[model samples]
Target: MIPTNRLSSSRNSRKPVCSRAVSRRGLIVAGLMLGLLGAGSAGAYGLCPGEMENAGRMQQRILREWPLRSSSDPASRFIQQLGVFLAQYGDEGIPWRFSLVRNLAPNAFSIGAGNVFVTEGAITFAQSESELAAIIAHELGHELAGHFCADSYSRGEGDIFMPPSEHYEVGVGSIRQSIDPAKEQQADRIAVSLLQAAGYDPHAMLQVARRLPAGGEVHLHDPRRIHSLERLLAGYPPAGGLPDSLTFKEVRRVIMGETHQR
Candidate 1:
């Protein structure tokens, strides 16, 4: 990546401002979370990190074999680049990485650490930079919140909706496997804060949410992209010109490829 720039400003106040009036569950660093996570969690949640790393490596190879409609997919590249901004440079830990997978389902998901995957359908479905990033940030919240680590124990208690199911690292610190409606809501709240903290517009995050297939029932065979979107904002689309809320510099920088170092 080109010389990295700060996510908040040129301008990374890695020490998150406690007075930002963060939402109840905003994804803020209590203090250098990523650094601390890297240091500890060696014995407990360590397996989660290993699982994430393995998933990332596997997806990278899968993308290598994906058949793209064309060689140039700026939006796809944008997703990858933005991911580097949020996961690598950001203070929040549990490193995230991005990849595009060939699928018709308009969806995306992050498993393990920073392992986020966007289906071809999703890329084709998104109209602008914000929709794609909204999906990505939501998934990132799951990874950061340690949602994947639940697979191991959840298998005995109930069904888990994850792939490479049996590979859940046992050594990882135990994260709650509650699939309760409340937890889903909590994850969504975190996504909103994460996107905002990363300088992506939260309203756009809602756009991705409204476009999702909605109803009282959730599909079993279908992926959870929209469900995840709904969780992020409880089915409300970001109103007004969310673009107006973006930091002028961050928006210009991302649009101009000033931060496409990845």
Candidate 2:
């Protein structure tokens, strides 16, 4: 309903270049073009004129479409706390807001502007805090790396922030976008760093990747992605840095209970 893409790692780009520089350059160019050619021309770069304003509108539109769990819910609070905790190690400029979507599908996604949502099914799917953290961290990676802008430009989608049509379905497959495979791999690498910095077992990301169904347009084939993650993990020491937190266990229990009742 947010008109956003789901999380699934794919493609193997052995070289991890600094994408931030590319993003910044693209934005600057987009800005210049907007000034010269006006708002209509800016869409050529996958940017809406006044991105921050569009982001706000986009967030509002998504909230309207999706049924989010109340913020007061314990499970919702846990997601917020975990997202904020992981965010501290990354970009401090973006005001990251994490929310629990009421959907039962095991998915997570970020609609630009530091907003991340994890479905109830995804929470239940994760076996531990670190695994859940991996999902959140990966979404953060997408935001931090400016994937939304780059992805939009690549596909020539012209303002991905636009509201969805009335006929849109509130299903996982309906909302998921197939991002470039290279960008997906880049996000995976960034998630590893975020997990390590947050004292989570970096391997937790790999674990979740393995559990995901393979050969979807949104995800890389299992073997290639697994091999890439394996190579990346080889650089880190073999220490399980942290265990699942009691908070996550409780939150998962509450969410599972509510899900069953529904």
Candidate 3:
């Protein structure tokens, strides 16, 4: 067990919401701890006793309790088909299953063992099939990379999973942290390559690039707060980066059109 004193000390130095604010970083530590093994046969992602099962429960409740259930439209099914297409190429097709979450939030995320869930709002916001594919492909990329098993460790961070999930708070934190800035960028590069390898349009990723926040341009990236991912997809400072002329503004216009996101 991590020393109580050390945990207290770590908590004291943090901001009021520092636990959450720095949550992503702590998640990284959990993952790095696993790397200490130095070498091994890769285990699995989201196969922990409670990991995927817990996620299923969480999602099921959301469907039951939330007033905003996803639409049962054909478009949603179509989106699922697109996801299925991209998933077959993933390293974990048998274990992974794709689902479209009927929520609005313009968010897309995945749980290990092939659980790729994309929000309805994110899909509605997408201008085309390829654009949607870009987001799904990116999340799928993380699952295929074995980020879950990579982050799981006896680091004793107590499994930072969200409350009631039998995971340490730190274990949950490390999930997002598994891919650091460098690893994140590498993942994006790999996402694009994977999408292309699967015969999707390479430039389809540009739509996601354009949809990123404007503040990101200053960093020479797609400023969506996913810094590592943005820089990788935006590609900059040479080294096979995107052509210098492709600006965020151009991409933004295509995604935003005359209407702006509030």
Candidate 4:
């Protein structure tokens, strides 16, 4: 596990009322899931008891607080399919669940235990399916690397629940847990490998990085991170990967339509 101290401490301390409400709901949902699901063994991930319990709670909280696009929605299905496809190339310890969030921020995050989420903003922001795949692949990298468990353990609090005032900014930013630069680079490397293995244009990772705002609390888009990706991709041939599909275009259109209707 990556050391918890390596995780960045930089975060905005503003908590909106809605965020607090979500925390309360999360606590309630955590209790219900604990009763229904039981605190199973940590299994191969070697998660601590608290980490295992909190993972289920976090998943439930996200589902309850966010308005996920219906599974029947084309955009929702597309993201789920792409995420599952990429996950096949990584760890298989937990069942993966991918869903599109209805929020307008171009964000993606993983809550460990194979749960990944991408927002409608991300679907529209991505120019091609490969770019969106790059995002999902990156989140998979975090999960596969066990960053979540590491961060939770580092807190020494034995709980995966973040402070109520800590809010992960929307858009390509950190999760509720602040991932440090080294871990970010590690995830980026894993993302490129996953993309290559899954037949996505690995350079699409660079393309997405280049388009994001650089240098801020959003370290995910820092120029240093982009350069690291560039170095990582230098050896791979750029052109032979999969092309954008009609389905991707259709999903984008559907998501955009939904966004406009709101």
TM-score of each: 0.52, 0.72, 0.51, 0.71
Off-target runs (Cα >4 Å) in candidate 1 are 1-50, 53-75, 88-92, 150-180, 214-262
- Candidate 1 CA-lDDT value: 0.45
Ranking by TM-score: 2, 4, 1, 3
In candidate 4, clashing pairs total 0
Which candidate's lDDT is highest? Answer: 2
> What's the lDDT for all of these models?
0.45, 0.65, 0.45, 0.64
lDDT score of model 3? 0.45
Residue-level lDDT of model 3, residues 184-226, one tens digit each, is 3444554565455455554556556667544421112334425
Q: Residue 176 of model 1: what lDDT?
A: 19
lDDT (10s digit) by residue, model 2, range 224-249: 66778899999878859688789898
Tell me which of candidates 2 and 3 scores higher on TM-score.
Answer: 2
Q: Which candidate model has the greater lDDT, 1 or 2?
A: 2
Candidate RMSDs in order: 11.3, 11.9, 14.2, 13.0
Specify the highest-TM-score model's number: 2
| Model 1 error, position 2 (Å) | 11
lDDT of 4 by residue, 1-262 (tens): 2112211122233223233223322322342344321121111232223445556776666766788889898778888888877765553344678988888877788776677889888888788888999988888877666666533433342334343343333323212455466657777877877687677898988898888755432434667788898888898896568888899988888778878898
The TM-score that candidate 1 achieves is 0.52
lDDT of 2 at 150: 34
Candidate 2: which stretches are off by over 4 Å? 1-49, 150-176, 215-222
Error of 3 at 217 (Å): 19
Where does candidate 3 stray beyond 4 Å? 1-54, 57-73, 150-179, 214-262
Q: How high a TM-score does candidate 3 get?
A: 0.51
